[model samples]
Target: MAGSSFDNLPLEWIRAFEAAARMGSFTAAAVETGLTQSAISQRIGHLERRLGTRLFVRQARSIALTVEGDAWLPHVRTALESLRESSEALFGVARDRLTISASTSVIDLWITPRLDRLTQAIGGQITFRTMVLSTDAPHDDDTVRIRYGTGDWPQTYKQPLFSEVMAPVAAPALLHKDEAWQDLPRIAVSGPRPGWTEWCALTGTPTVPIPVLRFDTFASALAAARAGRGVLLASLPLCAADLSSGTLARIGDATLPHHATYWLIASKERLSRTQWGALSGALTLR
Candidate 1:
């Protein structure tokens, strides 16, 4: 705000108004910024009084930016991003901060091993959090969420990660190539997800395998498979490492085309340009 006509304006007022406008709700702004809803309201009123114009049109269940707010939004957003960049340049990123919400299978099999690369790509000290979400779990807006399904999550932005092909993988010890594949023991999981039934149809293999065990999570099933317990249908990409390391072996050359997709999502509120740029590039499909 230096060297400007509005240099005397309080920075907090601008920050509060920016949050309220971007979140489209005073309550949501308060939740995101750790301010009280009443405080957000008061700050908006204070800012409007100083500017001598209404910035928000309050409604029963929603809030919309007025013409004045709409005009000022982009400038404020750019200024905030600039301020953050300048502060980082001077402070050298005091602490790394990021949080991700994803499924256990993705975390254990896919993202966990690649965390070092992600950190290196971001180029800074970082504290990362991973929340294990179920396939049908709701989105937690406070962190970047990974979803498994069609690219439709309400009130958020979606970025495709990678769709996974289904395949049968098990420990090499469990495979008996001379024996009939359908007669082998099959491990399964309990969820609203596809499994050996779908895989059998895709590969033209018989669905007459006997079930020996049923786990509740893919991680557990994978562990059992690696221990030479039984064959399990798993996502091809997620288990690629195990396949490469000779821990898990595919039953045959048959592979099913990908259907379920993995998507990275963020809430509707705008983020710092630098932060998004760093993460979005770091997460780009390899």
Candidate 2:
């Protein structure tokens, strides 16, 4: 076993090791891999023996990776991922239907507006899954994802949808009120986006009153602003239609730019070059 080569290692044993390490539980690994718990344990045991090293420290309720296991886990994951991607790219069935996962705000405000052009360009049917959290992982069947980030995901094809620019906006009726835009009530949205304080700092404006209404999701906040509840710090790209339709008016010329923005990412292994080109070309802002 001391001189055992990787060529002799079984794929099942490697899969078991990877699953157990990622899940930190032999039982959970079994569930994911559709194998019995004892089988997972046996495979991992054989793998450890073959490598002449203890991969995990067994505990009554949980397992923790040994130093050597932790060090090697990343390499193992990368190799397995490469193998899966290559197999899919070279031999997987091609489907005309694509599933995209994204936030409700992005779907309603950004993608929906471009749906017709996108559909015509890709020549496919599209399905949408609304993301509950921005940080949620892509679903197993999702072919594409619209994520809010700086375009730094690894091993995937990604492009920014638009530059991240934000400004204060209010319903036309709200803007017509005698009160100055700065004195109007503010709508606050909770998340990573910069808030009223950051806006004031960037614009060199004085501190404003606290928000009278706050919503956790951007969609809800945008709705409140559309109803003239308050002035909202809105993403210009997402609210472009609102601004164009006279549903919302910009408060001033000042805008805040951000390093992060919405990114359209696709599975490199799942999409062919032509499909990827059409999808990206149709959705990306010029």
lDDT of each: 0.75, 0.86
The superposed Cα distance between candidate 2 and the true structure at residue 60, in angstroms, equals: 39
For residues 58-112, could you state the per-residue lDDT of candidate 1 as single tens digits? 9998899999899999999999878876875675533255667676776777676
Residue by residue across 101-140, what tens digits does model 2's lDDT show?
8889888888888888888886767898888546765476
Q: Name every residue pair that clashes in candidate 2.
A: none
Clashing pairs in 1: none
Cand. 2 Cα-lDDT: 0.86
When summed lDDT is taken over every stretch of 10 residues in candidate 1, the lowest stretch is 268-277
If scored against the real structure, what TM-score would every candidate get? Answer: 0.63, 0.67
Query: Which candidate number has the best lDDT?
Result: 2
Which runs of model 2 end up more than 4 angstroms from their true locations?
Answer: 1-93, 136-138
Model 1 vs truth, CA RMSD: 6.1
Model 1 reaches what TM-score against the true structure?
Answer: 0.63
